[model samples]
Target: MTGSTNIMIRKLIRSLEKQKKPLWKTVAEKLQTPSRKRWYINLYKIEKYTKPGDIVIVPGKVLGIGNLTHEVTVVALDFSKSAKEKILKAGGKVMSLYDFDKLDLKGKNVRLMKQ
Candidate 1:
């Protein structure tokens, strides 16, 4: 992950911690494993911690596993075929992380930084 993205993830984790939320430890653990897959990250933590209108940043890739009920806009480095289909079908949008430069993150209630 780029330096900025890493900073973002750290910030989100800290926010979760401040809220006494359950997701901080799980996400922190996932971030520690070098070989961990994107599917595991999304299935185990990211989706659980995020909500509709939120922006999710996956520094790596996205995978299809759990269902996403929220109408969030996901920005990732890459996405699996099934994930793309599911996100679109749910009226959510997906884009490359680089595309985030064009978005307004301040407009959202939550932003998930996934590595």
Candidate 2:
């Protein structure tokens, strides 16, 4: 937490840690690290590993390097403009980690993916 330079990301790390939930803590720990260590998932991985209607969490940015073939909800720290467009075009939802936090979607129904 002390090494993180981004205040907004730092705040997210703290807030998630304060939740006192195991999954939140794990996500907080991942978020607390430097940007270089975060995941940078692409559309292809999401498409290859997930099925329709799945909620996916990427602890870093979501790049628009590939195509999405199904509808799925994706939550991440950042997303490229094209990634957002592609997700919407594929009938999928692109959400920020903060927005995903608001939904309080339990870990059970969510699928956490990394780059």
Candidate 3:
């Protein structure tokens, strides 16, 4: 990951720590490679850590490198072409991170993380 991305990831981790009941959890074991090179988020982790109606954020970009079975909404900063299609096909919704901030998160279980 780039320095800026690392900083953002740290910020997210800190934010998650403050919540009494975090909307989601990070369950994957650490990989040997750095984060940026592994642009794709793990669908299994998302499914395991989040529930329906949770919004997932990817600070960089999302790649269509995995299968998604959960029906949660994904609001990322950006997404690959195939990622968008797969999300929609799986009956999930997709939105830009910018649009997600405009909505009210009150009483909602939303997960904002860098994936």
Which candidate number would show the highest TM-score if scored against the true structure?
2
Worst 10 residues of 1 by lDDT: 35-44
Q: TM-score each candidate.
A: 0.59, 0.89, 0.57
Give candidate 2's whole-model lDDT.
Answer: 0.83
lDDT value, residue 30 of candidate 3: 20
Q: Residues 6-91, candidate 1, lDDT per residue (tens digit)? A: 56555644543453334344444444345345323353254688777777766557788887776778876568888888888777
What is the lDDT for 110 in model 1?
48
Model 1 off-target regions past 4 Å? 1-40
- Candidate 2: lDDT of 62? 92
Model 1 scores a TM of 0.59
C-alpha displacement of 41 in model 1, angstroms? 3.3
Off by over 4 Å in 3: 1-40
- Report residue 111 deviation for candidate 1 (angstroms): 2.2
lDDT of 2 by residue, 1-115 (tens): 3568878888888788887667678778788777788888889898899988888888889999999989999988899998999999999988888764576575455788865
Residue by residue across 1-115, what tens digits does model 3's lDDT show? 4333455555544554454543323311121125555345655556667777777765446677777776878876468898888878878888864453354556657765544
